[model samples]
Target chain A: MQSDNPTAAILVIGDEILSGRTREGNAHHLAQVLNATGFDLREIRVVSDDQDQIVAAVRALDGSLGGAFDLLFTSGGIGPTHDDITADAVAAAHGTTVVVDAGARALLQARCDRMGLELTPNRLRMARIPVGATLIDNAVSAAPGFSIGQTHVMAGVPEVFRGMVDWLIPKLPGGRPVQSLSVEVRRGESDVAEPLAELAREFSDLSLGSYPFHDERGWGTNLVVRGLDAARVAEAMHAVKQRLAL
Target chain B: MQSDNPTAAILVIGDEILSGRTREGNAHHLAQVLNATGFDLREIRVVSDDQDQIVAAVRALDGSLGGAFDLLFTSGGIGPTHDDITADAVAAAHGTTVVVDAGARALLQARCDRMGLELTPNRLRMARIPVGATLIDNAVSAAPGFSIGQTHVMAGVPEVFRGMVDWLIPKLPGGRPVQSLSVEVRRGESDVAEPLAELAREFSDLSLGSYPFHDERGWGTNLVVRGLDAARVAEAMHAVKQRLAL
Candidate 1:
């Protein structure tokens, strides 16, 4: 069956994330947003803030392997600092040049002027954009994100990234978002695998997942049924509830 | 200088994670543990539960690309269900076979016996291990994880994964753990990039990072210095503090 959902990939660039100095929250945030917006987030790669690694990841996600997504969202490493190398890496990936976008410069300038902030050369670094890209408005901060081809580059700050996502969602085409129904079962996943697998086979349209988690009491399973067809998903969830006697 | 730290990569396989039904906590937990155990976590990839993709990722992490790590830790997809294909994928990548290990079966049998549970066929599926593999004991759930050819496969359950990691850490050789110190300043990253970069260049042995975050008040930058030598790292942090006038 042909899938109508627009596929997307997320690339999180930072050394702090990889170093375990900071727990990553942006990927989870993006995944939820993409799912709500009807975009199939196929893959997520977290690479250090390195030029070569970022460039290679971008190219590979574009189509290097058998997998290629429609949209690519990259977060982090766009701030005004030496470690923020995402812009140059992205430009190198596209074989394009980085230039100061007039719109971005004006936005930066206006924010600086209003805040009584000096527009130092380092601060102006945020205005640099890859050639032939459109600016993604940052409502929280004046530093603008940019969209080149299918890739959208946004800030790593959750608030700024959220703002850019809210702005970009309406402009892109989306498919029917998948609706989900879940139920908690006290039994372990292995105890219910047979019946669950049978139900999964019965409802070929829906995606059934058995996730095992531990709480203060003991291990339990959460059965989730997801599909574009709400009725089918509901039907599967009902059948699962009956089979598990929940 | 020759580096003594063992490098590692984490591959997370699950549709729930990719679909945003679940937030990933195992990677962060593993990263902290690996760091504390003196291993360098170089890369992390989150792929859907696909057999070919899993096999390909295992191969690539072993040495296929120019980027090769000393160990590859995979979480999830090793369960008692049709979707549990990690064992087969790992065996395929290593040109080996998956068989029910006698020791693993004994472990499962003992747990089942103690819990007054029946050893169902589906539940027994957890005993299957790749050829020439060593079982990493799971103290929480009794389902043993395995290590085959530098690839360690464990359960997705955070509790189980953490238990297996704790069991595995002492068995592996460790290097000197990196020490880190951080200072937060109200100034923006751009305001400190020049001097910070200069300080970074002076301390060749240390890794200097400038992370920008927005709090309720306003934007601020956190300067972190990390190195193997405590004295050197402390020295670098002191210099950074002095350079930024913090």
Candidate 2:
């Protein structure tokens, strides 16, 4: 039987990241948070803002990943601007139509009225949501993100995106947090690989990785041992140190 | 006739990044450098260190995109460790065999000699290169990266990766560098969406994007205009401001 923990994928939609105009802002944050909350972060994809590309990417992540992940988080392209087409693309991917959801519209209307700004037709675009979806609150900005089925769409701006994630992550089910430890070996990674592979086979329950790093001191390998059980992770790291003579 | 500038994609091969243990280190650096040097970065994908995933990613980017890009740069998995499977995956993707290249072995030997370390078999793992590929020098660390066809492989370490990029970028053919300008509008993106869309249509040749931000002052959108022609870019920005009455 599968564990109760859910898997997740992050789809970053933006031309800025592709053009090197902006460094990634939201995905990393989400990754760290998801790990701490016990959800598995499976994949991250960065695509341009083109509609077809966005729709295709959504379907590929949602459909072809073989239901491996329980939730999909998308950042960027949900704004009111022309380039912000994430909402429509998600709708298209799910074979649904986007409409102005009452909750989203009410949230936007309250925010606009409080700011003494008229809710122009263009501004109202932010209220549009795919039918049969729930609004994800945006504390930083009034424009709410929405979750249609398993896909969640949010703003690209870091602060707003973080807010939405904070608001939504707790509602989802999660497994036990993964425990990990690292052992720094003086020997280079290749020198350790042969034995490391043996250790990996012995510690089948633990996920082991050898990270080769070259710092000012010299090149060395950091052996990382991770598992859902704290005791198993500690035992694996202890065995790694003993086998590698660390 | 098509512009002379080349297009590129960055493949980040690592499990740490996908697992949120480490943030990305090199892709942003490459993106900025590529843009300044006139190459267009079309996409970036972060996949696990699994060989199948690495090979599939390489093929997908190099093959499926209709040769949409001219160069493929990969980082990580070139170390002497068991998880360092990038070199073999790259070779597999190209249907080539990985053999110990004499030049790469010499480079590693010299560095090992200088450092007074034994050239163990594990250490020599770094010398294995795809047949018929040219080695990319790693000034910081002696283990060099390699290039086969249009695919360029480099170390995952930040310093070595940047050094390899600096050495290789100059030799590749490049088009005119793109010019860009930013205009901060004191209005919400939705409020500016209509006119902005019109301005974008008018400046079809230029790539324009509206980025919404929320700071202490309030929510506003930064309009970015970019193009190869400097004069056209300025003209487009001028018309943008004029049309928006900013």
- Residue A191, model 2, lDDT: 79
Worst 10 residues of 2 chain B by lDDT: B60-69
Give a tens-digit lDDT track for model 1, residues A22-45. 888888888988888788887888
* Model 1 chain B poorest 10 in a row by lDDT: B60-69
What is candidate 2's CA lDDT for residue B243? Answer: 86
True lDDT of residue A86, candidate 2: 89
Model 2, chain B: what is the TM-score? 0.94
List A-chain TM-scores for all predictions: 0.96, 0.93
Compared with the true structure, all predictions reach lDDT values of 0.86, 0.83
TM-score of 2: 0.93
Give a tens-digit lDDT track for model 1, residues B120-219. Answer: 9888889999989999986788889999888989999988998998898889887878788999999778899899878877886678899988888898
DockQ of each: 0.78, 0.65
| Each candidate structure's count of clashing pairs | 0, 1
